[model samples]
Target: MKKLFTTDFKQRCINLMLHEQHTVAETSKIMNVSISALQRWKVQYIKEKQGITPVKPAITAEQREIQRLRTEVEQLRSDNALLKKVSAFFLDKH
Candidate 1:
């Protein structure tokens, strides 16, 4: 059976993947959708914005490595922020 979704809902999903930096697979899983469905939605969303449909690009190993590094950097930044907050709290106590 084919399910009908609103344009607003599709835009929100695309926003999650684009603006929020969520991976397509992550957004798909979170939204209870298939990755391919999300990909198609993304393409439609782009076309709506730019008036042109972009070709799907293949994922390369270097792209994967860059994504992995970006994730790691975000994690490290979060850990550093937590450590700073803890340090400030202890220093205030002393």
Candidate 2:
């Protein structure tokens, strides 16, 4: 039968490997889990603590939109400035 660990238990396992300085192998053995599972949990915990969650996918979409808007705005500004310059040059000539 497979064992299902709770959130608290999963955090505890990660803490043992991190704060307690236990190796992944040791934590897996002590927690009765696979080493791969412990390693995966540790990676997720570290990423979460570093503010790099899977939620970044949403931020990525926002960032892409912001970049696109910025590019469009810059192009518009450049076109407007060029038109103004042309208008001023024609006014001076006339």
Candidate 3:
């Protein structure tokens, strides 16, 4: 059976490798996980750190605020565009 790791466990493994400056092979051996899994976790870790992916529940307050603001801005922009279209339609009908 394949072992399933929790997000916390995956993050801990990635952090151990990164913060302790351990190579992927070393980390894999120490963590008892596959080297390929470690490599993939490292890539995912970097992407999450760079905000390229939606972070898990461990996201900081600042990141949460930024995400909320971004969502609000997108919604506002969509609403503005819709209003503009409606205005244009009304004006054309007059």
Candidate 4:
């Protein structure tokens, strides 16, 4: 995949495509991003541009902690399995 673009550049391109009513091809050409990529951003921009203020991402700290705990649990389970295999190998040899 191509390198990700900066937030400002992407928003600028989306604004041009949405607010200024520029064609996706023209916006992509001006912003130097792929037309398909520009189209995707335009979809999001158009959705949120409706009412007074923009809605922010809804993730909470508790949700983030839950995700972190899930990852740690997966890692610990993997480590325990490896340790069990090692212990069984030593027992079998001795």
Off by over 4 Å in 2: 55-94
Show model 1 residue runs off by greater than 4 Å.
Answer: 53-94
Report how far off residue 83 is in candidate 4 (Å): 30
Candidate 1 structure quality by residue, lDDT tens digits, 1-94 = 9877765677678889999999999998888888888898777556545544234321333433555666799999999999999999999999
TM, every model: 0.52, 0.53, 0.55, 0.48
Residue 67 error, candidate 1, Å: 36
- When 1 and 3 are scored with lDDT, the better candidate is 3
Residues 1-94, model 4: lDDT tens digits? 6677765677788778767999999987887888888776666555444421223321233433555666799999999999999999999999
RMSD of each: 13.5, 11.2, 5.0, 8.7
lDDT of 3 by residue, 1-94 (tens): 8887876677778878888888888888888999888887787667667766454432334445666788899999999999999999999999
Q: Could you give me the TM-score of model 4 versus the true structure?
A: 0.48
- Quick one: ranking by TM-score, best first? 3, 2, 1, 4
Clashes of 2: 0
* C-alpha-based local distance difference test score of model 1: 0.73
Better of 2 and 3 by lDDT: 3
Prediction 3 TM-score vs. true: 0.55
| Alpha carbon lDDT at 18, candidate 4 | 65
Clashes of each: 0, 0, 0, 0
lDDT of each: 0.73, 0.73, 0.76, 0.68
Q: Write the per-residue lDDT of candidate 2 for residues 10-59, one digit (tens) a residue.
A: 87898898889999999988989999878877776676655554432212
Let me know the TM-score candidate 2 reaches against the reference structure. 0.53
